[model samples]
Target: MTRLVVVGAGLMGEAIFSGLLASGWAPADIVVSDARAERRAELSERYGVGSGEAVDAVADAQTVLLAVKPADVGGVLEEIGDRLAPDALLLSVCAGVALATLQAGVREGTPVVRAMPNTPARVGEAITAVSPGTHATDDHLAEVTEILGAVGRVITVAEKYQDSVTAVSGSGPAYVFLVAEAMIEGGVHVGLPRDVATELAVQTLFGSATLLRDTGDHPAILRENVTSPGGTTAAALRRLEDHGVRAAFLAAVEAARDRSLELG
Candidate 1:
């Protein structure tokens, strides 16, 4: 009986809505809004859910999801400022839009939860971090977590740390992709065929992630386990160190965190 409304049926919004319905929530229990007429029509029929404009979908919903792009978020909030159900919880999936900004635009005392979810969420393997606004409560947190938990793990972080979350995991997928690209190129450099190189690199990345998750061991320890003295991994690691990969990653994450703050 949880009536949910999602604004913006774009990639991330669609992914979350699909994840919820696939997790056994009834299709009729949800609704979505998109500025594009074709998108609204397509998604509603495809998901067997309701669809309409942002101002129209929150009619009696328990939660209204703000999934608009960061750039458009303010305008959408301002547009619906007078119409949003006063008591319905507002859940934002737009990155870099701070809780204060959302709260200021919404009715005073309307509960708001700010969340940072990554690209992997599309495949149902995201790790999301949430931060509560002033009017949000324990019940609100649980509800937001349930919504996000459908697609992946959820963690509570202080609002102050949300920007860092944006840096680390929100933008983390690009970092992993870059690593995969480099690994594939490294394999090609070592004379392997493209398909074989891709397979090796991808499976290795997947297996390494699985190992960390399955064993619950420290990643550094796991790396140590594979890094025998003067072994292949050690040689490659040494080369990576010489190329300053670790330093570059640190600098990149820091830069992203700063940019997130600027956007907020």
Candidate 2:
């Protein structure tokens, strides 16, 4: 039997496949499916994995990864619902779509695991959150975690917390990029060359993140460490606070959470 079938050849799909390969899974053990023949051909050439129609791909597989767009998920599930092996595990990465929705589309009692992964998965640096459906067992959740861990960190959360997870991490990268963009522009406004500003902004973000991760320090403590009394960092931070930057972030995350709930 095929060990895994990834039912989409898009960015995240490709990333997960690549990560699995990097983590020592044989290409022959996996199959990928895409609606576009060209996409299937490209993935086959790029990864040397088997490619075919979605239903055919999952027919004998032990695990089926549903990576299609949220709008397309229902149709894909309907196509493969009856064909999926009775014991196959269904793992979904469709954003905003709930486990209830996935459970409704698949065979009754199918063990569905809903995952929210960010764009950074493309680089194998993503943090994915997995929430189990009513039928999913601890072992099933563990299996999904192991599969996603091939790419980056994987955290298990209750389904209720998934919307907040979607907001905080699923949409988190764009927030970081916006900050990086503003920092780069700010550096340019202060007379730095654009290229130099870009490097500075990028490295600063990278280094700060590394520091926080490596040292296991609270972000506030880390921020305080760099902020001297009446210093340049202090002045900048004061301006950000005066402009309600912190509150804005809070509001933005809440809005994203609300939107995620609406999507579900």
Candidate 3:
């Protein structure tokens, strides 16, 4: 059996297990650990992976998924650093934790893969970006990619880009939601019913994205295709420019990236 272990058993931890299983790995081959007794029991009952202690769960796992919080990763890695299998791979979903920090806990020279996945993964519509540490080989990365890609689209970037990835895709969902919220309010302001406004705004966003994705045209081109001179879109664009929306997005993402670096 191809043994895989997931630590933390939180939302992302559990989501990782679910993603692996959906990608064809059997429950018998996976193990999960959580510090809280209730979480362990709950997950074991739900997924059938035994609710063992962290060290026990990861003891022989071929790939250990570090799904703990950014702050907790160091301690967990330190705790199990010496106990992991010599050749086992380390995969982490904890944002802001650097590759070097992860390698410090595991066996010397073990492979490590770091990933940033957004909240949409809960519904299987996530976008994730991954970067490998120095020890991670192509084959090892492929394995990690396969696991993360199960939940959504996966992109591989340099670790140098992970912080930006965190700000964009990782924090991007919230930005989209905020836009949706504003659109819905705008619709309501214009006399549309709340529910109808929400549905229309959401569907428009989804349809626009779908069209852009399916048409294979660049976003700039697709957007230009929609905006006629002196059109409604152009009017909205002027209002958005007046409000400095684009600048706000740049500032927000840049601030998030800086904060991620600061946290690490």
Lowest lDDT block of 10, candidate 3: 1-10
Q: Model 2: runs farther than 4 Å from truth? A: none
TM-score, model 3 to reference: 0.95
- The window of 10 residues in a row where model 2 has the poorest summed lDDT is 117-126
Residue 222 CA error for candidate 1 (Å)? 0.7
List lDDT for all candidates, in order. Answer: 0.91, 0.92, 0.87
lDDT (tens digit, per residue) of candidate 3 on 197-223: 999999999998889889999998988
- Candidate 1: tens digits of C-alpha lDDT, residues 1-264: 337999888888998989998899898889888999899999988989988788877756789999999999879987876677778999999999998899998899899999999988888999999999999999999999989988999999999999999999999999999989989998999999989999999999999998999999999999999999989999989989999989999999999999999999
Candidate 1 all-Cα RMSD: 1.2
Q: Candidate 2, residues 116-209: lDDT per residue as tens digits?
A: 9988888788999999998899999888988999999999888899999999999999999999999999999999999999999999999998
* TM-score per candidate, chains pooled: 0.97, 0.97, 0.95
In model 1, where do residues sit more than 4 Å from their true spots?
none
Give the local distance difference test score of model 2: 0.92
**What are the clashing pairs of model 3?**
none
